[model samples]
Target: MKIMKTVQKVPGGMMVVPLLIGAIINTVAPHALKIGSFTTAVFSSAGVASFVGLQTFFVGTNLKFKEAPEALRRGSVLLVAKYLAGLILAIITNKIFGLSGFLGISVLAIICSVTGSNGSLYLSLMGTYGDSKDTAAQGILNIHDGPFLALITLGASGLASIPLLSLLAAIVPLLVGCILGNADKDLRDFFSPGASIVIPFVGFTIGAGINFSLIIKAGLSGILVGLLVFFVGGGLSILADRYINKRPGYAGAAIASAAGNTIASPAAIAIIDPKYKPFVASATTQIAAAVVLTVIIVPPLVAWMAKRYGCPKFDEQKAKNASLQES
Candidate 1:
């Protein structure tokens, strides 16, 4: 069995499946893994925190500083649009619900979920339906690797008084890795796979921290947030790509999906502000669900938008492939 191929066939399966499996095991037998030996070393919350930090470092190494200016411009436009969408949502939600949150959803979670783009999904879609410039934008878009943006937005809103040093602490690993990677091509290649390889471990660790019951309560709210990410992110990106970037806007739709790493942001935020701890479990679950929801929904929407906007090669190939399968 082509296990890797099979797994890759499912949208976000690499991260999502491990997460679900971990969540189920942890839910059913919370104490089974706590045998006080090697099991504790690998799956404990401390272990997860280590992996999350390591993952951030790996992601930083993958950023290419010497990319074409056009790629940076395109990516910046999308990033700004995505950030603004989530910032607007956070501000509105804060005004209405304040720090207490509403209907099991917190402003912190809302900001994190909407602001971060699913780079994996975006790359997949862009590879198929977009141009080189579109795909290259991942370099700049990846800066949203951690919870820094969410924290920054919250601080800006006066909802939280996060220390500047804490904000720098969150970004320092990525910055160090970026400097090392930029200085050495070999180092970049070596650390690049670490980003992908560490995801399942991180996902499993995050899943184990969550309770399935919280997932059930947050599922619908997460789905609603995912839909909002799709439309608002998609709409703004399309406009930016067309007007600002002067390119076909397929990338806009492609990048509108919520990122898998977003599942970690809620917990990361909780670390920054203990006040957010109450919402962390539900927010984590909700963000995980949103990642899945957007992964499934955004690709088709991108294809449709591509067709409507007059990109036929992608759809033509897709139709050809589908017909070939029928034969």
Candidate 2:
């Protein structure tokens, strides 16, 4: 009962707390632990492992492989929209600004890929717009952005060189969790507590990337890029929510896109571009900024959009009706 009560109170508590702890450690003691690159890699690996374990424990309980096709289909559609949006924007910025080389292009791509944990938060906040299936799908889809960002930033040449084995090492556990969740409800319940633990780690790791120097270097150009990606990506997502989802009051979904998942981007970049360690600081700062912006801005915008568009309240009545019809 205590565990249940805590879980109820803090939905993503597990993920959020450790992340703050990490940030505090970074801020207070970055130099305290001078582990070599190998140790750093070990820490990173450990973090990923924790995340995968948490995901597996929760998702396994919720697994329903029979539903995999539908989930995959939805995930694929979202992936395409996400990648296409980022790629086009990056290309335009590169062409117009006369920016050359992978560095500039990669930075722009990273910005686009930084959509945060809004989908999970939206699932918690909106309460009615999404069902279990929608929530599950969002969880799975959220994991993809990191890998996709890595691929895009690396480009064709680096893409081939990227350590696929390492990438899969990070991704497979989460996938396994989701698959398990589809299969067993009890397992999902067991792992659910870990979600709160792992979720904030995502935030913290992303936050650790933030340093003052990189922000100064990025200056006005980086700020502009971040804003453009946030707004345009947001707008396109809104359109998709309306036309594709065909569900009323879908502004929450739009906000999810705008919320840019910054935490994963830095790690992705680190893995892809060893020479660009400093850029990780820039990515981190940008992600922190994006997180603040998304949390503050996206929710209100979604509410306003819903009201303006005459979106009906997603209440129990609607749910009951849908459930009955489906049954």
Candidate 3:
């Protein structure tokens, strides 16, 4: 009961429970189900689940396309900040630190792409910061990490390795959700509940991919890489939020966004470099672990920073609810 309660309290924890179960199954009985490539199956299922979840959430919630402009502006700012941070860092790492392999590039790209949990969670927590316009921006921006990583990998390698089609496959559902969200107010409300269901399955697939053996092999180097990206990438987000936006919560928001790149990077890497499967797999696992850690840690850090900076907290929920009510 206590564990269940704790999971309920945690953002996206219920969704993660299914993922944990899947991982346990893999750990205990690796050969139980030869499900025609676990990664492909899991990813495919996740895509469908996400689509259903988003449709359900948005179907009932009122969405205003008029506010699309505001959402786009904010979303663009955040996306640019995220993209440049990753691209610049990856280049620097490659040029200066001799970290030029696919693993190194993918790791750096992943780091930059990391973004926080969708603004909905923050809105829910902060209660007042709920703006549907902002949430819409957040939703659109949240999904950009995968495409941006793919673009970066393509640019760096001078090879079109990451499958354009695969990236599209991942992106189409989210895009559809956004469109459906704008089309019908009810769609957002309907889709929101399903997010709770879909997220955990995604988490389970991620956990199932984790291999202790690979982590041991990568050892300190991988750990160092992960930490460096988390810290440095996180710092860049802060700077962008502060200097670029002159907003307090923006820093934390940026950090949150940067943290989610784990999901994006591995998928991109798998498509790009099939030969280095283990390296990509290990890097993906490490990135996912980093994302979970950052999600747990960065919000409080951002809250503290916001308090210190005396920046007004944006109540995303209030704004969202207001928008819905107005609509």
Candidate 4:
């Protein structure tokens, strides 16, 4: 029916709608997807990684041979700006709160919230607002996920290395897609639809991993942490994109989201060092709220930024092909 047009009208609807739907299911029944067969395989949390990886390969098909360097620079800008925002959050919170933490939010929450992003959500948002190179930037952003940042920031030692395999998992598929797309232009066009096709499924998979109830569990501080993740972390990332990366701020706004898995960082960090133990539960809760809030918030923020400054799309070839077909 008119569903496609209706969804396209919303800000990041292709991703946000399915994500919210999945969240609703998860919060309500939670086990409905566990009915087995293809239902569980595709709709369950188990499918999130596969969907994300597939989208990455398809997005790579859009990037050409020349834009690779710009993607690296764009990624670097986002990486630095995102991490600096988190580090600043830690320092400011430490100065004002003095380790007791303000409200229910704690150092661990800010550390985890600021240091990285929702890579899957970033890919989804990029599918809407970003160019091929913008999507390629995700390959470099693999550094943001996991407890590595918390461990390093909290001064915990000897846990794990830089996750080389994670880097490879990100880069390899993109490179393969790039080589093939460059070799056959029509193949790029053929596979490009896969990027959008996978968004709803991936969004749903990611949402299945979240529980909106956690926001309530976190209380007012939970909401505050979400706003901080959006304004402090998301805002600065936007600025970096505009000023440093020399583009519209959509990509930066896109990355401000706290990954759903980031909820576990507090406990993981506490495992490494007992000093962070007392704060783990509260921090975990606050981060969980941030994850939910950011998902609900950042897509609209990116959409607004895009509407105001113009969408940062880079599909001139696609545009040209469409024009030729019309003629």
Instruction: Report the lDDT tens digits of candidate 4 across residue range 1-327.
Output: 899899888888999999899999999999997788899989988889889989988988888989999998999899889888998889888999976578877888888887879999999998887788999998888888888876777777477678888789778889988998999999999998999899999889988888899989999998988888888888899899999888978899999888777778888888878888898888888888889989888888888888787765534546778999999
Q: After superposition, how far is residue 181 of candidate 1 from its true place, in Å?
A: 19
Query: How many residue pairs clash in model 1?
Result: 0
Give the top-scoring candidate (lDDT). Answer: 4
**On TM-score, who's better, 2 or 4?**
4
Q: Against the correct fold, how does model 1 do in TM-score?
A: 0.60
Predicted candidate 3 versus true structure: per-residue lDDT over 105-224, tens digit per residue: 444334434432333223222222224443445544544434445445435445434456654554355467667766766766666555434445545554454433444455554554
Candidate 1: stretches off by over 4 Å? 1-67, 156-217, 312-327
List TM-scores for all candidates, in order.
Answer: 0.60, 0.55, 0.57, 0.93
Report, for all candidates in order, the number of backbone clashes.
Answer: 0, 32, 51, 0
lDDT value, residue 245 of candidate 3:
54
Measured with C-alpha atoms, the lDDT of residue 240 in candidate 4 is 93
Lowest summed lDDT window (length 10), candidate 3: 121-130
A best-first ranking of the candidates according to their TM-score comes to: 4, 1, 3, 2
The alpha-carbon lDDT assigned to residue 138 of candidate 4 equals 88
**Alpha carbon deviation, residue 320, candidate 2 (Å):** 11
Q: After superposition, how far is residue 315 of candidate 4 from its true place, in Å?
A: 9.0
Clashing pairs in 4: none
Better of 1 and 2 by lDDT: 1
Off by over 4 Å in 4: 157-159, 314-327
Best by TM-score: 4
Off by over 4 Å in 2: 1-25, 28-49, 100-171, 178-217, 247-327
